[model samples]
Target chain A: MTFLPPITAYTCVCAVGRGRDALRAALTGMVGGLTRFDDPVGVLDTFVGRVDGLDAVELPANLTDYDCRNNRLAELTLRQDGFEDRVRAVRDRYGAARIGVVLGTSTSGIASGEDAFLAWSGEGPLQSDFVFEHSQDLYSLSDFVRRRLALGGPSYTISAACASSTKTFIDGAQLIAAGLCDAVVVGGVDTLCETSLRGFNALQLLSPVPCRPNDADRQGISIGEAGGFALLERDEGGSGTALRMIGYGESSDAHHMSSPHPEGLGARLAMTEALEMSGLRGGQIDYVNMHGTGSHLNDRVEDRAIADVLGPAVKCSSTKGWMGHTLGAAGAVEAAIVLTALEAQIAPGNLNLKRPDPEARCRPLMETVPAELRHAMTNNFGFGGNNCCLVFSRDDAR
Target chain B: MRLRVAGISVIGSGMVDWGQAQRILRGAESWDADALTVPTPTILSANERRRVSKLVRLALGAAEAACDSAGLARGAMDCVFTSALGDGAVTQAVMSALRQPGRAVSPTHFHNSVHNAMAGYWSIGSQNHQASTSLAGGQGSFGAALLKAALSLSQSGRPVLLVAADHPFQPPLSGTRPTDGAFAVGAVLTPDVEGAAGPLLDIEGGVNGPASETDTKALHGLWQTCPAARAIPLLEALLNPKTVVLEAGTGYFLSATVSP
Candidate 1:
């Protein structure tokens, strides 16, 4: 984290829209992207941030077996913000074998696996085309991405539930720092699937409506799907406002299997460590993108941690209202949102926030506003108390 | 990207600990059936032990053994755990439920279904607050984990407890793509290469580079057996007088040298 690497280029496709322009417009317009959904997975009265046009999309002919909801989402996003060209340019500079690929996901291609299971129940034994090794294993996403890019360096999938994608940034930065690979292609893709939906529903954590994070009357999460990709480089050709990864901090609560620490102690440690790694003070931060999952404990605990780090005055917001709770994709998705906001020197507001949580000490901005931004931070916490915080600074900050 | 190791601990049907592993690597003994018995962790509470998946048991067992041999406290070590197949049983339970009417997944099953479940349980059980991550690279998971751990230890200047485990899939899934039972391998990588009793290794060059190969062909079963077992051959080369090499990435070889 001391000598941080530059993000250089990034792209995202989520429920909000397909590119950075779409994300910036939605953020500045106070628009929410969540929509009502009949349970594609099961019986659940809830909202989701499901992407459109995935079913009509086709994977490259040679990569037909890699087709799935998750990979489809990744393909949709990879074409955005000139991300593919950026990757190819980096490839030309550093040979395919010198660039590593790391991604994060929770249920990966499980939706395809679910289909295979349903097929088995009907046709007995899955078709050879099912390719369980590629579809079911968490490494499939990384494997698919690596093949798509034709990269031969280090590649793997980090599957730590909600914190997956956020941790990928840490992975990419560390790999570049360690000289494992000159440049690391890092990000994640997660699609709406049966197990994640019904699992949260079974836990009664899904809200019946679009989530309203930091609201006093917030109920629960509205699940969503999205993909975000970033290229982190050690070389110094990128411009200012190019979205550099400056600091990363991660810790586990060792306190819960599925819940946050009552005091957000792990969250606090992660945020504190991120700031410490950045060699910047909390007062120097211009904006904060909170996790703000809208679940009972998540919003409350995360707000407390934010207040502890940035104090009452630092502007902060949760864009989950704009993209829904993207689960594993949220880390990269929200980081993309922060990057868009940073580019415009504006901070996106917390959507659906009418009243603040009474017990909360920090309140997110209710609407987007243009401002000066030098340093920004995004927080992502996952199941098993895996907490991660990333710090990014304007290019001039270097 | 060299990983200078101070100690190692291995668990499988063939090797029980680093002592046995060294003996096998030195060609003093032979690898019979891998009789790995992943114990319920003494570090975890009774309820926590029951709550974790079987894969977690294998990883924790191997991890505890590795840390003990290196005399490194579990809490002091950062971890990078790798596996080819995660907890297949939980995945089976989940997929089966999805096939049913409402797709009612058990919350515990869903939580434990993640690849990092093993690392999560280890963090909670061992109280290691340092950075811990879990990942997979298909059959090359061990190489992926090894290179990462070596560089991390070198950068952080702290001892790292690296481990990899794999248990075969269950049921119809297993019928299609079956693994060779369960096995785990662990290494305590320390930056202190100057004074060490155990063998030392230097990750030398890149693809098609200089490194040693095990002469005893019986040990090569690990390459066909467990994905993490690929590290076993490299571990074996460490005990031998000759330097060793392993395929760290596709078309990229890790040229490693062992100390006398």
Candidate 2:
């Protein structure tokens, strides 16, 4: 595997807050962002990590056709943490055509589709104003981002369920390695949609209350909406203290679509491959950001996979309790949290974990603790048995 | 990037398989404008077979054909699945259910509604633990998947499978997001050219270019209506040995130089 470039700039927006400072506070303070479900469209009795002020958002006049809840969320996130200005600076250095855009999203602007469907009287042509290309298409997020940022390089959107955004790092690095771009904006955005809300409810995976990951009494997941992004560029002899992506691994379980493999075979393979690629032993990993969705099968299988690969000593936690399971955006959102923890030299404990499952072998942290962190790993497993593991390291620590 | 096309397959309304597609493109067989009949994927178990949607069957059918053409094990290569609008039928079904008094979305439909549902089913049927990525580049999905597969092959020095498919949306959705037909195309790409069954292709270019026109008019304008139909010109060039540049969408172009 090729050595990935450092993350030059990164930012995120969720129910907790916007920008890194807000995320840092949420992590260190152990505060959550979930709220009770009260939307008129949502009929389920559950909690959601809904971002505020989307209804008032307005896209630029030139991009009016691209208006949607998901794009609004993307627009909101891009403006936070000076992300847009930072991207502009890189665009000046690398040129607009030299920087690529790769975003991950599951639902895209499907909420707009739902609205259009709702407004239909079961008659003639359903609202002519509904633009499927600019809204509901899976590539809409990337398209809007690319145009919003005025980038002319190669762009695409990954939609591998929850593992969507994590895989963007791998693809972005490959794009640079293949000489397609000098830098790639990689991240994900998924907005609250009725389809996702009612769909998870149908599947019996939605927890009525806030998600309690790895808890003995944990129910399921609290669906959330979030958007996160990072600018990746090749290391041109930058400062030694820069945060860099050391390695990444991806795999498929070939077992089930919605359920994880019982033995966590694919998860183990992904982590093991990431370790091998980074040239580090499993014990060298100081902390791990687990994909603890609070679902029974997910947490259990992931715990087993971590035990098999990183062993039982590594400190692990799930931040979903802070911002529900963001689905497609979970990978990048958690990635931002991992970077934050690495910078502060503090490992965040599982937000909602009370009594860890007795069957689990890996240790689940219950309280945020300061630690000497060098290398960290973040795991994201998605539906369709897709699994991705990414390793990050502070150059100074290495 | 330079890679060898180890195998190729195509399935659509009239183009049932690669061989049949070649005959039609070569003017040997008449283009049939009949409704598409998606084949059942035998690679999957009966239990899984019963759960697959029409889009899944179309995608897996093309994928299995490509693997067979290359004499490659389905479990060996990494895969990239791309589609402009994935399983729209399921999306409509779920949304229609949400409109009712009780939004009773089917568990099965909800699960299958994911963009990566086909990728998930592919892994289960193939039992391949290799990395599989599902992505969308809107109308440019084919070019994006091809470039991604080429990049994967270059990075891992291994064979990669590329599959692109899109099925027509129903009723209300069909009004705005109209797809004239359903189509899928698959190819196995390898870094090594030695003993390659298909042509060696020099793939280059990126987003933003003029779209390419298909030389074969007998197939009608299916290429203009379906995203996957854009692969027809390239598939024709694959069998006939020529240079072809295909516009993936308004924003992407895939230029391929085929060497037999």
Give one digit per residue, the lDDT tens place, for model 2 in B35-109: 587999998999889988989999999999999998899999999998888888899998899778877889889
TM-score of every prediction relative to native: 0.95, 0.97
> Could you give me the TM-score of model 1 versus the true structure?
0.95
Q: Alpha carbon lDDT of residue A238, candidate 1?
A: 54
The DockQ of each candidate is 0.60, 0.70
lDDT tens per residue, model 1, B89-203:
8888988887777778888898888777888888888888777778877876777777778766777777788989887676767765757757787778878556654666676
lDDT at position B15, candidate 1? 71
| lDDT (Cα, tens digit) per residue for candidate 1, span A1-398 | 34588887888998878989988888899887898878665489999998999998777888878888888888788889888888888888878877888898888888887787877754457656677666767878888888888887888888788888999998788778877688888889899988888889878999988999999999899999999998888775453435687788888888777888899888988999899888888898889999998899999888888888879788998889988989888888988987777778898899999898887887689889998887899999998778899998777533
Stretches off by above 4 angstroms in model 2 are A39-43, A236-241, B206-208, B248-250
Candidate 1: residue A284 lDDT (0-100): 86
- The TM-score leader among the candidates is 2
Q: Give the lDDT of residue A254 in candidate 2.
A: 95
- Which residue pairs in candidate 2 have backbone atoms (N, alpha carbon, C) closer than 3 angstroms, thus clashing? B208-B251
